[model samples]
Target: MTRRTENLAGRALMAAFCLAVLVPFAGIVLAALHPPGSVVPGLSWPQHPTLESFTRAWSDAGFGGLLRNSAVIALGVVPLALVCASLAGYAFATMTFRGRKVLFGFLMLGLALPYEAAVVPLYYDLRAIGLTDTPLALILALTGLFMPFGAFWMREQFLALPKEMTEAASIDGAGSWTVLWRVLLPCSRPALITLGLLYFLWAWNQFLLSLILIQNPAGRTAPAGLGFFVGAHNIDVPLLSAATLIVIGPVVAVYLFFQRHFIAGMLAGAVKG
Candidate 1:
């Protein structure tokens, strides 16, 4: 095809994809703007759109507590996961040790394992340890569950760096920790930011683990709380839509805030690979 033809085709394809995503989202927004308990059929615009559904949903769903719980879990998971992933990635990428390959291979097995298959066993195990029904249980589980991918991503990023950077740091009398914290980390900001965003998003949106592990309504994550809210308000489309938007608001805000770095990190990884 000619260059102009290819450009036009690509633009058209992009627009199609954008509409595919935005159309459903726009429908939800419109539905939410209708009065609470109103039947919003097929994305019809409300004649008198109001934010009443949002307020009612927030109060009815106890979203303040739900969002707080989600934040707490996400905050707990992100730092712990990042620390473990970075350390493991650094060791795997830059160090030589026995059983390294075996260890990495074993860790990678987690990527292939279905988390659902382990949920029942995990519940029993955590119950035995008196950790079930607590935020800590979910936090720890999410951190561990995220480790395999986190480590793999960090390892690729570290491996793509020039060996001379580490060598120079070593010659400058920098220890492993110093080289990691001071030298390498500064260069890996995009990767770290991207990974942290992913961790936060996953932790915030983790419904199954939150639902299964945390029984206390007071400690339920936003997504888990939303599930209950959905069940209770199944017939209220506007209120349900409003509640759904509230649950996902933080994730959308975070992505928008870090859009540049996330895109850069993804592009960097793609080029390196």
Candidate 2:
């Protein structure tokens, strides 16, 4: 095929994919706009669109508390995971240590372990320590769960940097900490931002961990809270859709805000790899 024909075909394919995703989302939005207690048939537009469902769902679901808990867990997990990942990545990439390969392989095993398989034992373990039903439980669990991917991501990023950067910093009286903080981190901003965003997204959307660990209704994350909300109002499509939008709003906002950086980081990794 000619280049122009290939370009048109690709554009048409992309448009189709976009429509596939957007149509359902549009249906949800339209459903949420219908008057409360009224049945929405498929993707039809409401004659009287109202924000009442959004307000009602917000109040009923206690989204304020749920979102706050999610934020707290995400805030806690992101920093702890980032620090550990960065340190581990640096050590694995730049420093020599005994059992390094063995340890890394062991750590990578976490990537293979399904979250569903581990969550049951993890809940029991946390309950044994009386940490269940607390924000700290989710925070710690998510941090540990995220480490393998975070470490691997940062390791690849650090490895992609020229060795001379570290050597040059060392010759200038820079220690390991200094080299990492001053020289490497400045250059790895894209990768770090990308990894942090991923951590935030995972921590925010974490339902199973929050549900299994946090028995207290007040301490549940947004997604976990949404699950119960769904149970209570399964037939209320408008209310459920509004709550769903609320739960996903922050994630969408964060991604839109950092969209450029996220894309850049992915492209950088692709080129490096």
Candidate 3:
């Protein structure tokens, strides 16, 4: 195909995919604006839209507390996961020690083991330690579950760095830790930002682990509280829609800001590996 043909095809494909993704979000936005008793309603470019539901969901649902809990968990999880993963990843990539291969292999296996599989055991463990129903407990679980993916990806990123820089640093008598912190890490900013975003989104939206580890409604993340928004036999569709949009809005904004880097980060050096 010609260059123009390839470019045209790519633009069309991306436009189609963008529309596919946005349609549902458009539906939610419209639904949130629609009155409680509207009929034949399904996102028809509302003639009369309002923020009435969003304001009510926040005011009535005690969304303030839920937002606080979610924020605390996300804050703790992101830094903890990043620091731990960077340390482990740097060790795997730059250090030559006994059993390093075996240890790194085990870390990779964490990615395969479904986290839901061990929720029961985790509950017992946390309960034994008296950490259940606490934000700390949820943070620990998010960090433990999320650290592995970051470690594996970061190790690959560090390994893919120019060896000559490390050699140069070592020739100048810099230690391994110094070389990692001052040299390679400074150069891996994109990978770090990308990984941080992933951790934040996952930890922010995490429900299953939060449900098992945190028993209190106040301790639960916003996504989990959506379940309690309605009775068993009745549904509060507008409030639920508003809550859904609120919970997701921050993460969506984060993605929109870093979207240019997302595709590049995801596909970075994939074919070579």
Candidate 4:
């Protein structure tokens, strides 16, 4: 077959795959707008569209409070995670210290540890400390949970930088913190933003953690809020669909806004020699 034919076939396959993934979501959107008690026909638009479901779902599920809590937790976790990860990663990548390799190896173990394994222990620990059912618990847990990957990502970014940059800064009397904050960090914007966005997404969508850690429904994140919504509206497909869409809207908006930078950041380390 000619190259043109092969390219067309590949394109067709990709389009089909995308459609397959999107078709159900499209149905959900239509179903959300469908009249109460009406059956949603497969792959068809709503016959009697109404805005009531969105409003009803939003108020009844307490999404406003959920969104607020999720945002606060994400905002709390992302910066702390990024800063700690970046600093630790820089040290691991550049500095020689006693037990550095061992410490880093321990952090790396976090990457392989399942959240389920840690949740029970974390719950009891936090409860003992009187932090369970609080936003702080989620923030701290997520930051710790994210540390392994975050540190590794930043370490890769730091390692990719030329050694001469650090040498030059040192020769000019720049200290370690200054070199990191003023010089290296400015150049690491893409990687930093990518890391921060990833952390934000993880913290926002965190379900099991939010569900198990916070007993107060008001402190739950969107995904966790949707869990309650699911139980309350189990048989009401339209309401359930509306709640699901509401929960996903913020994540979708965030991706759309930072798509270009996100793409670049993801590919930044791919070509390193």
Error of 2 at 107 (Å): 1.0
Q: Candidate 2: what lDDT? A: 0.93
- lDDT (10s digit) by residue, model 1, range 1-273: 999999999999999999999999999999999999888878788999999999999999999999998998899999999999999999999999999999999999999999999999999999999998788999899999999999999999999988899999999999999999998778888999999999999999999988899898888999999999999999999999999999989999999999999999999899986
The C-alpha TM-scores of every prediction are 0.97, 0.97, 0.92, 0.94
User: How many backbone clashes can be found in candidate 3?
Assistant: 0
Off by over 4 Å in 1: none
What is the per-residue lDDT of model 4 for residues 1-273, given as tens digits with 9 covering 90 to 100? Answer: 999999999999999999998988898898999765567666677767897889999889889988888889989999999999998889999899999999999999988878799899999999999999899999999999999999899898999988899899999999999999988888789899999899989988989989999988667888988998898788888888889999889888998899988988888878652
Pairs that clash in candidate 4: none
Position 110, candidate 1: lDDT: 98
Quantify all predictions' global Cα lDDT against the true fold: 0.93, 0.93, 0.82, 0.89
* Runs with alpha carbons beyond 4 Å of true place in candidate 2: none
Deviation of model 1 at 149, angstroms: 0.4
What ranges in model 4 sit over 4 Å off? 1-6
Cα error, candidate 3, residue 143 (Å):
1.0
Cα RMSD of predicted structure 4: 1.7
Clashing pairs in 1: none
With candidate 1 superimposed using the best TM-score fit, by how many Å does residue 204's alpha carbon deviate from the native? Answer: 0.6
* Model 2 lDDT per residue over 1-273, tens place: 999999999999999999999999999999999977889989899999999999999999999999999999999999999999999999999998899999999999989989799998999999999999998898899989998999999999999999999999999999999999999889999999999999999999988889899989889899999999999999999999999999999999999999999999999999986
